[model samples]
Target: MSVLAAVVRELGSEPVVEEFADPAPEDAADVVAAALNPVDVAVLNGQIPFRRLAPPFVAGLEGVARLRDGRHRYFFAPEPPFGSFAESVPLAGAEMTAAVPAGLDPVVAAALGVSGLAAHLSLTATGGLVAGEDVLILGADGQVGRVAVQLARAFGAGRVIGVVRDGDSRRVPLALGADAAVSSTDVDGLAERLRAEAPDGVDLILDLVWGPVVGPSLAVARQNARVVQVGNSGGPDATLNAPSFRNRGVRFLPHSNFLFSPEDRAAGFEELAARAARGEVEVEVERVPLAGAPEAHRRLVAGAAKRKLVLTTTSGTD
Candidate 1:
């Protein structure tokens, strides 16, 4: 059977919506909503050397789908060549699928999977966030960073500071529960600004943009602080001052969603979904039809999209 999907015909090219063969019968599920993430762009541009896929494959790795029995599930890591940016996709097994919480919007469920898991797990499981401790979130204007700001507050952080790229972007994190929002635009003065906001030093740091901003962020870390590094949106490389880093005894923990176990990922997603359903946590999302995948990819690559984008099918609305 042929189904509509966004197909990547080549590396560095935008995904084109077209009719593609349906997922194999044994593993097939009808897609409801699929999220568009930076990782998907990275894979499309061949930035991830190890996870390369040949052209003519579906475009998304995860989404909300309907099982054969009409039960809704949020599935991850769909079998390659048949991804979630389609009418139907192939699941690896039951292990890759989790039940979406009751009354959760399918688009929000899909949006919360990759970005939400990264934010929630980075703080709890990876950064070892403790109640009443001070937290610092770099790149807090991004999807994962936005969620981190709210999660930090929800998890009982005494103070939460978010560092954003633009001066105007400060309002985003501030509105989302960050105690203070600092701008990284003035790289030279970042340390001074952060120190002013967090005089006692931060206990946990979620570093999402690891460029020149990292040095200033580390400068404000209290002794024995845990720094969870999740992304390099600012840049791939960073230079750390040897003495400042060592003297503070900062524990640099690198985080990736792929490193987490299936059970942990599922639990994290469920918790985030529930919180979103209860209105305790919120993420700015832009809904687009599946056929708009090409334009969405272009916006993502150009860094013009500030909100999380979720592609919805007719099934998703029902």
Candidate 2:
């Protein structure tokens, strides 16, 4: 048997493919899934926050692979070569991790950890989210955004407003449970519709596309509305009116933690598993042989892949 992977072919280029030996069934993981998360880059860039696992390491936070035995299968992360966008990271020791088993495809399963877990924390655990509260999911097509839309539905949100880029069909986010989907694609019309939907202002703003994109959206929130900062794709900095927030009692709550308590991680796994089992969430995926692991990084960086890129490893196979 052989393992497939995606690899970084060159700097600022797309990831390519290569195959390697497969893991014996005895060594293959039974639990199959790699949960993606938003981890900050520490040493280099992408996988910096995960430097604790290994400095100069492959940056992906999650993925899912077929497993055998009781072993778990996930994207193999190795210590990347410092100061160079080189090949695959080292895979010496058994560092494979397992994620919750749900009805989710391997892509969705790989996503269960970071993005899905983030959704669980932002909407349920911290916010005490309940039914009838409206949610505004900005950048709903992205990984975290998609999960957030689904989470809003599970928590019984009264309405979900999906703000998406131009040329994107609203049906995808709508299928994820958004009541109304708007386009940020038309910047001119975005503000009016955003304000119109929130007669009292949106109860919660999941700003994955923060920065200037946040301006018009913030202006429309009602008193005591909460804004959760998840991503800064728009830019790193933005101005906010302190007096306005104080006067309206608007709250800014950024999700600040990645290391879920073991209990919390366990709970999230259970929750996502249930969702996958029910076929509530769908994860689109693109898979490659183990040798292409580097190409996976390249493509991921190039913004060329819409689905989660999966790298198959030979760690556990016949």
Candidate 3:
């Protein structure tokens, strides 16, 4: 049997839709919706040192799939060569999958898998967010940042402030439940802008971009506040003044979704899914057909995809 999938013929190359041998029934699950994530791009370009895959393989890291029992679930990290972008993916049993909420849309479920889990876990587990506490989300225009804004509000944040690189992108987070949005276009004035919105300082900081902005974002951290470092989209290195953070006793925590146990990840995703179903949490997403993965990949690499992109199969739409 053969199945259609987005295959990367070589590292650093665009994915091409083509037929590939189907996985055996014992190892395969019917794919519904697959999320295109930055990690997927990293893995594709061989940028992830820990996970290096040879080319001519299916392209996607996580997605929503149908189990044999007719229940839909979100699965991640399919064994190499078999990815969620395909109609049938070789998922390794129930260990790598989580049950999706009954009423959640498949595309939403897919979007909520990787990015949702990151935002949900980083805020609650790593950042130790408390109800009525002020929260700051860096890189608020990105997928995770956008979701984090909504999750923070839904989770009972007192004030949610989002920081974007461009002034025009500030509205992206504002519409997603952030109380205020600040542009980091001028790094020198970022701290002032953040303070104007969060005069008392933020209780929890979700730092998605670690660069010059990190220093300013940290300046407004309340004493004992936790800064959860999720990504470094802005740059790989950040300069910080030791005394600034030391005097406030602010805690910096590094976060990786892979570090969470499967159970913890599932619980976080389930909670987000529940909230999304009830309209309490929402992520801006663009739905693309499975065959359009190549174009999606191009947009993702070129940084043109402003919203979360989910590859939907025919069955996924229904």
Candidate 4:
């Protein structure tokens, strides 16, 4: 059998299809890719200069594609966790598996894995989240941020405060399990107002924004609170006061290593996907056929029109 892998052979590039000797099913059965990850985006963004690491390598970073022979189909990133892309890649089946729940289409279920990984780790592992805790999810309209709203609630967060700029109530944290939701433009002194609602201060902060938006709000964290930094959506540069952290005994956890450990990735995806299969985890997709991959890539580079862009071979427009 021939394996279909996307290879990125150069710097400032995109993945091109390459064939590999599909190993005997008895050897190892792991195949599926979800989408380009933040590191892939970083490489694409030239943050660390992916080309400097290795030349003529596989460029597709993360995905939840499929694995045959009784394996779980998922959206997973390849491991090492970090790659220069590669000449030969062993797509980890664990990171790729996502449970296909009833009432949820495969594409949407496929879409949930990567987003769910980020949401799960932040709320459980790093945030040390517990039942009845209140959370402040900055830039909550983002892919992972939006899902963080739901997972936090499902994990038993008492209230979720989401910050977003999208029109319509799509960013509503309440619907996603937040007791209340707020728009970023909802009047002045937003953090103070939020503080008023939770007098003791918020327990966990899932921040997609890292700059001016969240710097000041660092004060809103309770003593021994956890602030999980998942995205640089607000720009990478920020002014952080040593006193604020020292005073609060706050903890900061980096969010980009979701694919770092396959064991952890497997456990995380399995749990999240089970929820997806049950209709608790949801994904909204703007699907494009395989032939449209090039155009879709262009749209992504130009700036995505919607949060999730899923390429699909099947049509289940339910």
| Candidate 3 lDDT over residue span 1-318, tens digit each | 989999989999888999988998788888999999878888989898756888888889889998788788898878877788989987774346887888888788898788888899999899888899999999988888988998888888899999998999998998988889999999999988888888889888899999889999987899988889999989999999988998999989999988989888888888888899999888767999999999998898888987789999987766
Model 1, range 4-95, lDDT digits (tens) per residue? 99998998888999999887788788899999888898888778764588888888878999877876799986767778889988776534
- Once model 3 is optimally superposed onto the true structure by TM-score, how far is the C-alpha of residue 316 displaced, in angstroms? 1.6
Q: How far is candidate 2 from the true structure (C-alpha RMSD, Å)?
A: 5.2
Query: What digit string (tens of lDDT, one per residue) describes model 2 on residues 59-175?
Result: 344454453333333333432421111222222332333354534455456555556666667776655567998888888888778888887887788878888775465776877
Candidate 3 segments exceeding 4 Å error: 93-95
> Pairing residues by index, what is the TM-score of model 4?
0.76
| Cα lDDT of model 4 by residue, 62-95, tens digit | 4433345434455344443222122223544323
- What TM-score quantifies how close candidate 1 is to the native fold? 0.95
The positional error of residue 82 in candidate 2, measured at the CA in angstroms, is 15
lDDT of each: 0.87, 0.58, 0.88, 0.61
lDDT of 3 at 114: 83
Our model 4 lands, by Cα RMSD against the true structure, at 4.7
TM-scores of all predicted structures:
0.95, 0.75, 0.96, 0.76
RMSD of 3: 1.5
Please report, as a residue range, the 10-residue window in candidate 3 with the lowest summed lDDT.
90-99
- Lowest lDDT sum, 10 consecutive residues, model 2, at 81-90
- The alpha-carbon lDDT assigned to residue 242 of candidate 2 equals 84
Q: Relative to the unseen true structure, what is the C-alpha lDDT of residue 74 in candidate 1, on a scale of 0 to 100?
A: 95
Q: What is the lDDT of residue 92 in candidate 3?
A: 77
